[model samples]
Target: MSITQHQTEAGSGMKPVGKAKARFGTGRSEFVVVAVLYAVAIFLTVGTATMNVQGKSAPGPQFFPILVCIVLYLAATLLAIQILRKPNVPDNTVHPGHGQFSADMLHDLGHLGKEEDAAYDAAPSQTPGKTWKTYSDWRTIGLLVGGVMAFVLLLEALGWILSAAALFWLVAYALGSRRPIFDIGVGLLFSSIIQLAFGAALGLSLPPGFVGGIF
Candidate 1:
């Protein structure tokens, strides 16, 4: 083949890689899911929404959800546009690490025993790719989902305080919290504050369960 013909044939044979560009923290799939969920929530909100009869100017029940939906939709749309415009570059830096909250707590708590510290030290450099086929940690995702499901199942029985505390602790532990004592303490404290803020200040009644009198 002539040089120009050979070059043309080679160029024709080469295919461009069509990778989807996404934000650093969030993937395109995640963005799509969030957008869809927000849309679903908006629809659900619309179905049961009612305007407040107590006051003439009171915002309808669906207003907040609609507003949130709009914001989420805008974000998702922007993300989609960006993805379509820019091709995704392979990222080696996108390795799994201990959850930010848990990692910070461990840092603040100082060093533990040498044995525990040794084990803990390895977590920072350990990539999910070492054990898993993909960069994303399905184990962490499963644990998070299971924790949320457990919280939902236990919520009515255990009440907001206990359930929320358990949920917080479960998430922290799943994310590699080294100090159980601190995790539990922080969870309880955080849940209590949330209860106070919502139940007491906002007058939003939360399930008190067996400990109704205490709260």
Candidate 2:
């Protein structure tokens, strides 16, 4: 074939490939996902904020849920804005030689390559760095659970003051506290404050057990 004829054929073949890339790019897919997430956040915020909580306290049942919904809405809005501002570039051009098939196959298939495969190959390796660390911290979690369990078991028999004090010390030690004198003092202080606030001020009747007459 002559040079002019060969150049004309090559240019005609590239036209379909360009059109396919434009049809199914990453920008369109990301926009759709972000939009859906934002819609869900708005629905949750509006639905929960309007619900009534029948309790006589500063923070009723509805307080925490409403706070969480507001946070979700704000985060989703920011994500959507960021996605909108990002430039839309053809996937194949961004990171060359990463797609499942060559440019010739994409032109012949008349479709943009699967965008997710390209994204996955482009992602950075997640191999741990010097800052990374492993943990065998089940002992800590177990100690905390045991402490809470002990409090629940002893509350009715030992009273809130003794039960809560023991729980505080156990949990503090589990969290790596070493000073026994300070730990015990802090535990006593915490239990006493809780007794005063919940039992006396709030009029919530915690089990008094053996020391029922003292308080």
Candidate 3:
């Protein structure tokens, strides 16, 4: 096409065919995940509040969970709005055809995939280091899952103090905290604060287990 034709096309606000508009986020996957979490938060907040709390005033045992749900709701609403404002990005994933895949075809596909990956890696992203991509890594994921499991198993047996302290330390370390001793100290301090808030201030009881006498 002529230079005039190109200028005319540009002036006319015509977008190139097959090229999707850029989205604010990397993908809609994040929005979907956050949306699901938001729903869960609402459910938990409402569900837990229904539990009996005899003679307790406002902001009782259900207070903390409801607070957390509020934060989640705000975050999810903001994220959803942001995602909606941005244009939708098309999914470009390729899937295998029906029946067994051919070796030669797979080989050719792999080579092409490598080239595309290389190009993507070479290009700088618009929001480098802004997102929490590494937080979902296998090691981090394992630590989180293990910590939750351990907390559940130990909550009643070992009690809230020890179990919560361990959970805090594990999560902090998993998220890249450098000092083990410091983390442990902070973890214990945090658990103590929570215990004081609920047990002492709010007049709510927590599982004391073997340390029932002390707590």
Judged by TM-score, which candidate is best? 3
- With candidate 3 superimposed using the best TM-score fit, by how many Å does residue 188's alpha carbon deviate from the native? 0.4
Q: In model 3, how many backbone clashes occur?
A: 0
Q: How much lDDT does candidate 3 score?
A: 0.73
| Order by lDDT, highest first | 3, 2, 1
- How many clashes in each structure? 0, 0, 0
Error of 3 at 166 (Å): 1.0
List the candidate 2 regions with Cα displacement exceeding 4 Å. Answer: 1-133, 213-215
Q: What lDDT tens digits, residue by residue, belong to model 3 across residues 1-215?
A: 79999999999999888955554565555677677878888798878878787775776777787788888888888888777776344333332221234334556666445565455566535323332112237999899999999999889998888899889889989999988899889888988788888877678777887888763
Query: What lDDT tens digits, residue by residue, belong to model 1 across residues 149-185?
Result: 9999988888888898888888888898878888889
> By the TM-score metric, which is better: model 1 or model 2?
1
Provide the global lDDT of candidate 1 against the true structure: 0.65
Q: What's model 3's lDDT at 188?
A: 85
Candidates in order, TM-scores: namely: 0.52, 0.40, 0.61
